[model samples]
Target: MTTRISAVPRPAPAVDLAVPFADCHITSDAQAAVLRVLQSGWVTTGREVAAFETEFAAAVGAEYAVAVSSCTQGIELALRSLGLPPGSLVLSSTMTFCGAVQAIMHAGHQPVLVDVDPATGLPTPATVRTAVQAFGRPAALTVVHWAGDVADVPALAEAAGVPLDHVVVDAAHALGTYAGDAPVGSGPGATCFSFYATKNLPLGEGGMITTDDAARADWLRKARLHGMTADAWRRYLPGGSWRYNVADAGLKANMTDIQAAMGRAQLTHFPSWQRRRAQIAAQYDEQLAGLPGVGLPHRPAPGQGTHAWHLYPIRLRLNGGIDRDEVIAALSERAIGTSVHFIPVHRLAYFSQAALIPSAGLTGADALFGQLLSLPMYPRLSGAQVDAVCAAITGIAHQGISGKGTE
Candidate 1:
């Protein structure tokens, strides 16, 4: 039998949740790992951080991994490491976080916005080619893997006429995401992953860059820690040297051992966490499949690799007299939180006047922006909670059809 919200609206059950759009899942082991770091005396970037890097690199099939303070910093460092000339142009999707564009500016380059595919909310090879045609060839292409869906970086680079090494993947939403047979980070160019509180790997605050380039990895390591030859662990440990040199001026974006310890512990449970995420996404797919004026998220094809399901975004068909904001407010009344993935970069204040190569028209991104609505998604969410969320949506959708829409 199909679940439905009661017309009488019964009292809230004990398990009834004010479900937030995102929630951090912290295990006992993760807490213990943090405690161990607190008692270890050396809590800065040290053995724990080093070990985390090695293990993370192996997990993603990358030759090297450099941990940083945030994904934004990782993107900046990755861009700077490229040794691209000043004032160079970089191509990126308009339907992405502002940080990705800011990173290009931080690296002393200009950003050229490309329209995304409305269905996937990611820039396609055709879009990349069109952007390049409009604003000369870019020095690099920064592809944002939107909502845990991996973008075809190789094809996008080829379309942009940029080398594979010149491709930088803003994979902040993609941790468990895969590309073909290999993981996302294993692919060409520098791929950045976020370990924020809401991310797949919840380290509270940290990011990592994975790449196969040894020279770039070495540069990133020093660049993340003020270009110092040795970090605190190398200088303060027994039988270590105090003499150090600053090879280049760099930002202080090093990840602490405390975060790294938590990350290591989180990594141990990551596989199971990923499986749970997939299960939750499947439940959403089945439950919300045929609702009128409700558009489900795009599914990946056979060889496109698996989606990480970071954000379960659905589109509202506005022509059916349904307002996205109204739906959000109704869901809020039911104590179910929701969000919008992003507003196009061009629409933002800073970016509107910034030195960005404006696209002819961000048709796809513009269309998708109006209807985008992200539902609650997290590993700890119960099946009943999922059903409740779906039932609430179904009721609202039916109400719209009957001319009783939430206005």
Candidate 2:
């Protein structure tokens, strides 16, 4: 029996085309929460934000959580909170989103790009040691949990010869990620998470910074709100003191009550959504495995770690004469959306001049960049849609090295 996928009808194939690379998962509950917040008079960083901070911190096994406008700001705030001297070196992954490096720069640190492991496309302890050898002791090291897979933070910290506190995790894709028995933010380093529209637990545009240090958490609270000793919610509320002073020259990046309301609702239903994401990934793995030159998202063996499955990225084997761009175009023509995870930071115009702290060339990053493609992976994506996506990928793979459809 042939399974039919329900999607917008297209003129050519008689099958509806256009599957987005990613979509926001907002249920009626989420919608109601947002509406309630809108109706409530206290709409800016009030009860909803406070509740979200508390709940999210507990959920991630962190001592404290500070809500912010975006993960980029959270990264910058975490860096600034360290009070590193100007021009201090900060080793960062070359394979991450540009915002990670930009945050380091915004915090007045010089970023030294480091290579990533070819298999997982994440920086390993060996890479950290290599970077430390090439560059002197960095004031800090920023590691990204690429594609929601937890990086070996403890080992990397040890290799960098830095205390765990000196390591900052760019966990933008790893809200539910775990390492061994602990969650991503449960570790010693500051873990920053994103709530972007396309993220796993998005609230349109917000972020959270989770850490174990009480002092740092307190400082970040002030720093996120223009360095004010007290936020407006406190001042405007009854019996609250209006006499407050600026603590630090902080950036305006506080999360609003509206965003937090949506976040709160999403957090409540996160477990089920997460399970669906894992299921979709497993389905893709089962169907797409052994397709000529195509690669699928990697999963750790049981008891190893938990992958958040934020993005299901596949690599096209260049040796098979697969042109990634051409395949992307073919998918697009079929109404299947796709994207590249990232172009290496060193290759970007902004970071082109950045020095690479390498024992070897950035060949690993470059190699990964050449073939990586992100497929749609969201909780709302139906099983039939998953099948359609897999079918499309399989069809493309069977087209042979020439990229000509076998049909």
Candidate 3:
């Protein structure tokens, strides 16, 4: 039987919008998983860590999943393993988080900034081509399922060429997202996933690296644990001796058994949690589409695939005398929690001329940033909450611009 979210009617204009956007739902199973790890007495990397790696790899259709301390480390190792030379162009969208840019620089690479589609703040294959031309190389591109629209990676790869090196995906938002039947990491190249507390899969602060290449996987394993050859042997095996070689100067970036324990539990509940996310998204689709100047998140084209709905952001048009920031503040006044998905990396202090991200101008990125707003979207959000959100949006919108373009 298809599970459908019930209809959430618009609330009266006087009532406080009782619905907030997101709430993380952790089950007793998650507690049990953690307890098992505690009782095992091995809190650091151990059997639980290995099990997490195995299960996560299988979930994303990757040959290997190396658990790491954070998504930054995952991205950092992915770049180091891709064998891209120093200062090679690492292309990423300015429409994403600053961490993506910061991680590339940390891995000793130059960030080639790509602009996003004005309509959706997504870097399409063509936009990537523009950035590549500016850099004059087969630059490393980080594909984002920005707001869960899986960019055309197949066409992107075909046009860019196969055996594509340095194509690391910042799949922080793409755990359950699918392109046809294939998830983000299922495609060519390495993919990084975050298990940040707010992510669909919460493990407090953890991450995983996905790759199909055995040699590359091995190197990442070493790099993620301080570039030493003895991590698995010295720490994991008893009486195996501590003598082992160091590959390179690495960092302490390994995920603990405790964190992996949570990952294992999340995997168990993700199926139902993901279904709830889908049902909630479906309701948003029907309700938000009717509101003016409110452009809802994009869905995959027919046969394109499924979206994980990591965020439920709506772009409110600003041509109507009211600014996007004004709408957000008004929502806050009405007890609705909202956020901007990003501030567009190009606008950051790091990238503002000091860093100099290439674009004819930052025209495309700045345009998109002015209108975006991320509504709450965690699995625990109730149907009643969804209705309150919709009502607050409509109310704030009408008061701001009358749901019609500014006169």
For each candidate, what is the lDDT? Answer: 0.88, 0.85, 0.77
RMSD of every prediction? 3.6, 4.5, 6.1
The regions of model 2 sitting more than 4 angstroms off are 1-17, 318-320, 355-359, 401-407
Task: Give per-residue lDDT, candidate 2, residue 272.
Answer: 92
- Residues 1-407 of candidate 1 have per-residue lDDT tens digits of 22222244434543444776788878899899989999989899999999999999999999999999999999999999988999899998999999989999998999999999998899999988888788888999898889998788888999998999988899899898888778889956899999999899987899999999998999999999999988879998899999889988799999999999999999999998889989999999999999888999986799978899888899987334657887786787688888999999988989877846444788899999999999988899889889999998888788666654223
lDDT by residue for model 3 (1-407), tens: 22111224534564444555555556688788889889987788878888999999998899988899988888888887876788877777788888888888888888777787877677776776676666665546666778766777656554444345457878888889888988878756888999888788988889998888888888888888878886763555767766778857676899988888888988898888889989988888888887777888877878988888889878887334677777776676666778898898878878765344655866777887888889878888888888888887776555554434233
- Per-candidate clashes, comma-separated: 0, 1, 3
- Where does candidate 1 have its weakest 10-residue lDDT segment? 1-10
| lDDT per residue as tens, model 2, 1-407 | 21122233444753444687878778789899888988887789998999999999999999999999999999999999998899998989899999999999999889988888777898887777778888887888898889998788877777777778988899999988888778888767688999999999977799999999999999999999999999999898899998999958899999999899899889989999899999999999999988878887765668978999998999887334547887787777677888988898988876877655465767789888888999989998888888888898776666554434222
Cα RMSD for predicted model 1 = 3.6
lDDT of 1 at 10: 39
Ranking by lDDT: 1, 2, 3
Candidate 1 is scored at a TM of 0.94
Candidate 2 has a TM-score of 0.93
Clashing pairs in 3: 21-376, 226-250, 226-251
Clashing pairs in 1: none
lDDT of model number 3: 0.77
Candidate 3: Cα lDDT at 30? 78
For candidate 1, give the lDDT of residue 246.
95
